[model samples]
Target chain A: MAVCCPLLQHEGERGEEARRFSLVLRAADELCPWVEPVALGSCTLPARGPSRFFGGEARLVDQLGAAVIGALDGAGPVQIGAADGLFAALLAARAGVIVPPGGSATFLSSWSLAVLRRPDLAVTLQRLGIHTLGQFAALPARHVLARFGGEAVLCHRVARAEVGELPGLRDPRIGHRLREVRGELPDVTPQAGFFGGTSAGDLRAAGAVARLQARLGPEAVLTGRLGEGRDPADRGRLVPWGSRPEGRHPGRAACRAPAPWPGRLPPPSPMVVLGDPLAAELVDRAGRPVRVGATGLLSDAPARLSIAGGPWRQVRGWAGPWPASERWWSGRRRRARLQVVDGGGEAVLLAAERGRWWLEGRYD
Target chain B: MFVSTDQGGRAKPDLPAELAARARPVSTAASRLLPLPDALAALFPDGALRRGSTTLVAGSPGGGTTTLALALLSTVSAAGGWCAAVGVADPGVVAAVELGLDLRRVVFVPRPAGAWADATGELLGAVEAVVVRPPGAARPVAARRLAARARERRTALVVLVDHAGGWPFGPDVSLTVRDAEWEGVGEGHGHLQGRLAAVAAAARHPAASPAVHRLWLPSSDGSVAASPVCPASPTRSATTAPATTA
Candidate 1:
């Protein structure tokens, strides 16, 4: 018969707790420099080589427990169990009991079949009055295979204390000695103040943002790229960092200097584009409001426009009312955009929609 | 302004008289001058971009502002130092190749909007040089604050101020492309081959006198080289022939 040693009372999952527990496991590696440790919190280690090295299975478990406790500053309730298979070893560790070699089957014979954690098999066995692993294992192997498949047969072997396939260890060097300590990590965010400062604080801030991204997803931390489009609002595309841009390859498309558009506002685009156009008043010579006709023509010659504040300035060099209409099927609306250079040499882009004039953006 | 007679692109051993006067022990984090390519040396006071200071490059769309920015970034990145660019709407990859910038060492954040300051500050903390543009019309106070942060981190900040409005706040040094004339393109005679531009630079204190140079903003060879000044013109001119390094 082979041996399996299982640990109990694993650490919690918070970052600090996980780090502290990793430290304890690392220390375990130092003590049993050859046994590979498998994880569940309380780690499970194969006891063959380590047992031989430490005189016997009993001494090996005792030594590992002592070493782990010592490394943890004597944190108590370090349970270690050694048995023939993983299932029995885990149960034994939980109960702080060890089954002697060749007596694992006898020890497991009285435990409930539910100990295997196979709910369906346990329920079926219960319905059939087979309440314990001993009773379940006592059934004909052929009959168990025919009914529950190879998985059930493997369970049957584990219940009988016969060594089955082992799980891949989480840490390959679980029982291997750690050669050196990784140098102390610098403070994630150095206390560089708001302007320019230490990188530690910036690094820490980036780390925090990464954590938040992990929780909330990549969409929350957006990195935008300028794309080719006529409307200022549609010109920029916000995408998660590292993701490929949607639609056309906007990057290469806009590489060369674009052809000058007659109606487009020239270079020095607005610093900020208003999400929603603000209502304004466009007036004619007589102080009456200027209106647009249904045919996309101005009701009167537009002479002046006012936005946000100040006295209305006379429009000097004026451009077209490039009319645009969208969502015709849902709820059609028409908007006309005009580029107006005021008498003060200042320029602004204004849009008129639904018989109302609004300031779209500034050319400053 | 002092002038250099070395016309060829080859590196000159002797420093220009003007730069030699301005060359003093710079208080740098590495305690050494941050090197600039020899071609652009005429544009700076000490023949190097001083660390922990801000340099503003402003020009119209066709005025070679991007070329200048990539040129500055290339110098630092080629020397095995990391550099970053924020709010440069154009992808620097295509232009970096033309400017001889090492793409592998340079990091480009194409469009940093509202978080421009934060992003630039972070890059200043880590990279040797950072090139950025104001996401919006940055107030003078905000611009000064960003410049102060760069000083603290010992990282050089290069701002690509728009040619139309220029820099929101005064920079330690400013380079403006006064005018650019395209070459080879005649009515319908030839393709838009390259450009020649007059660049003017002025530094704060001591070097307040503006220095002007006419050069190939991007010569036909896709490299920025010093062009000789027109002999008939009174303005300071480099050699009419492109400066050849070979």
Candidate 2:
């Protein structure tokens, strides 16, 4: 089914670039319908499980070639090469595919010396006049190994179609996201009403409630437990708005209010009991709550410091070129401190030793 | 300085039409003098060397002047255009292999000891782009003739001038490669340690001002990597200014 199409298509009048891309895409698409299409370099179809699914290796490849031709719209002059390694497949593709199951070695053995002219193998092969793949394969494996090392063995393997391994396939479905959450709030009191709208129930019905919860600021929402077990499904969930699950018995249920919800809410209204106050805060060098640090200071050495996970930065503005030298007795105890302003407008002390300077600590 | 206050303002004589035309900014001339890359945008950013135009790439050996020329050749060939390289210093096979050049579309013309210019002239009209490393010096007149032939045929003629030698003819863009430094080796005993230096020096025609740019070459792993080169120094010559459009 596939063979006639690509062979015919290859004969058609199409731009070379477009033709090439389409040919590779169609080949891969047809050969491995189980695996999604992947275009890596010049060839498209790679080694995978589909070869086994279509009954033994030979049948798989014949099918792949046919698929390639079909995808190419029968423009075949399509070359199909299947080997354990990408390099081998590429070489085979360049050299043309082998017929039947075990013909790869014979096909590769007759290949020309020019194939070995790949940059990595060229220089070493040039000395021996081993220009073609056939010549390279004829050389003693041990001698080739001793001279060109492992690469020679690998090349020989490629030439002999004894390719040992296939490259790992990359995950195609990882990190894929499809759902989007949207909501409209009329007032702060009706914050839950927003989620209770059409989209909310639709998302809940789809079992995508977790995704919706993730979309709603997770940190702002608080979870509460119901006092009485009523509706089995709604026993543990209550939103910021004064909305409770409709059930026969009214028990204390888990309740949460998003602090950042858009809309006005009545001040001091008691919809849900607060557990603990949580707010974002910054810490200072001394780990104390202070308004600002002192800026005026005199020191000779320049201060250098860096923010956590940030780039190194130097400080300017000092009162004096004061020089302090210590550690003369111990031979390794020098320390010179300087004061400078940091990004936060805090004056900090920087120390220098053995010529290199550092911001040891900050001042309050 | 005393000015002639001659009120013989019997109205100054009107300038001649030819002089007036010269005085008026020539818009076309300004565009014609744009750098080759800018001029080449009309063709391809990675365009085929213009047919019949002589492009000069002059630099010291190992300064990537030849590499740049070969890269251009590769690009053209990859585009399915036919090309030929004549009078190259390195062996044709080795050069093709090193540059990853497609030899199928290329005709390698070995550098005949004394017949480089003649060989290039012979192949110029037949190929889409011809890279020639002419033997000895090419006279400006001969270069001009070649350039004229190139222009007439619309064939791209890339002339690799050895070292800092001057071009035989005024090139549409004569790019000169200057100061180059070798990137040092990494610690340990890896033979793949030494790569070409990162910096490249270039002077474009029309603007003859020299510029030093950091070059990133393709690596074995097929990753693009960067190397720093010496910064460019300001031009000293005041006579040449960049071509300005009216």
Candidate 3:
């Protein structure tokens, strides 16, 4: 299967567009398991294997048509072109013709010059009155080649059905890995001033960490926490990589630490460790959702968050002024509060009104 | 190439007589063309899906429209074409896995706010096939843009319509899935057990009349399969006597 993006020229910023094209290719890879996409001009795979598997060329084309339809699933209409070469297939698909075998030359013979005039090449061909493939092909190969340079030579070959060698097959075994970090600091105060007050800093910190991790490779970052004493220590862990410490070991510190008051400080709340730290959000462009990352919300926040590549968006209606404070008895006490809302109207309250914002527990 | 003719020295074509006969000029009105499959089938037919054509698969909730869509994906993947499922509200990863699809080969794109149509259109330009599950609240214009994109990219699209309503693009094929019958199997002689039912659906193709097929869960394996439960020939009575309940 080959994906050809005709908007390569019309869309400004070619690099960004190409990256988006790659994302679509990746998306196609995920939607269909049987067919491996070979990145050609946009993306292509040899039809020979597929044809054989489907019984014959005709069957293969039918299967391809169905596959394309299945892939689109009504998001929009789609066109499919399958043929012997990259150019031929694209042309066939564009013309809405399922060209039969040995019809490449005939198809090229009738192809209009407009088809060859890409935005990048239209100006160069106008001077020659080269309006059709037949007209261009009629010229002496050497003369045409001399005037247009290598492009003319390549076009001449394509028109004559002497296209260049096919691109090599891509490694089908390509894979990826991710790393991440998460933590929960409860019993901390919420400052009413900031987004979520106390937890806001940690969330921002987690965002920064996620961004840093992304630089290492393509990954996503997520920030969320549970409510008051719910699974205390406010659990968080990176997936597909670093994992929580397992089994009691002398090398690893246990949850308990000696309290300064000999029985105070809430038994030294459990420590947050980076467990199986795997990163999320592996994508090129096109904003394609490659994988789902961590789903958690700050205390007094929404129940769930859908993190693709940016800040977490609240899942349900939840707005907060989550009131929280720490070191209440000491002169060093702190307070904070915050609110979080999603584009879908769901809001979460992370802090309550106080002289200052303070960190508070999460909702779910 | 040489030309041949009859004894009077008239040039005759080298092509076979039958071929020559077939090439004879004929009026369009005289031709009998095959009817187009319903919009849904047109989009993902067992044969070539005509470009520039739109197919709409519309059904109510729990009608198994999504299941049918996934089944099409399985067919496409098995045939070796890259495919994608975009904007799927429910990822349904387990179901896809159960169908024996290659997870790596499939890409799942989640777009919550209908903004996915634009990005999906751009993506469709490069991929072999793309499936977009528009949010339930998609507008008519959004649907049209998607259709336009499909035409521009020459991509085949299968739109899953969640509600029973008309689509912006008068699809070349329209399919509706409905429950046909329900049966319950008991764990023991007097114990009521799980319920199973068969679904009857119609595929209306463009240029062609509608055809009906029945989908039922296999008794042994519990997988859905479709067969021509209703006969097309006119030899038998259109209506048969209903089976009596015990």
Off by over 4 Å in 2: A1-364, B1-48, B92-100, B184-188, B192-210, B217-246
Comparison by DockQ, 1 against 3, better one: 1
The reply for model 3, stretches above 4 Å from the true place, is: A1-364, B1-48, B164-166, B180-206, B217-224, B231-246
Task: Mark the regions of model 1 whose C-alpha exceeds 4 Å error after superposition.
Answer: A1-364, B1-29, B186-192, B229-246
Displacement of the residue A284 alpha carbon in candidate 3, Å: 52
Mark the 10 consecutive residues where model 2 chain B has the least summed lDDT: B185-194
Task: Give model 2's DockQ, 2 decimals.
Answer: 0.01
Error of 1 at A183 (Å): 18
DockQ class, candidate 2: incorrect
TM-score of predicted chain B, candidate 1: 0.79
Tens-digit lDDT string for candidate 3 (A1-364): 3544454312231123322333444454543444433332245556666667668766765665565445434433345566667677767766656666677767777777666545344456656666666666677889866777776577777766667222332323121111112212211112211222332323333343333223332222111111122112222222111122233341121112222331111211111121222122222123333221122122232333433244644332322222234454783633232333233422112322223121222110
Per-residue lDDT tens digits of candidate 3, residues B1-246?
654435457553355775444323111122221112122233334333444345566665434555555544543333223345665543333234323333323444443243467545644544344566677656788778888877776555767776546466565556565542222211111111111223333334544646555543221121234433443431221123222211
- Winning model by lDDT: 1
What DockQ class does candidate 1 belong to?
incorrect
List the candidates' TM-scores in order: 0.43, 0.29, 0.32
C-alpha lDDT of all candidate models, in order: 0.59, 0.41, 0.40
lDDT of model 3 at residue B14? 58
lDDT of 1 by residue, A258-277 (tens): 44443443333432345466
Determine which window of 10 residues in candidate 3 chain A has minimal summed lDDT: A263-272
Q: What is the RMSD of candidate 3?
A: 28.0
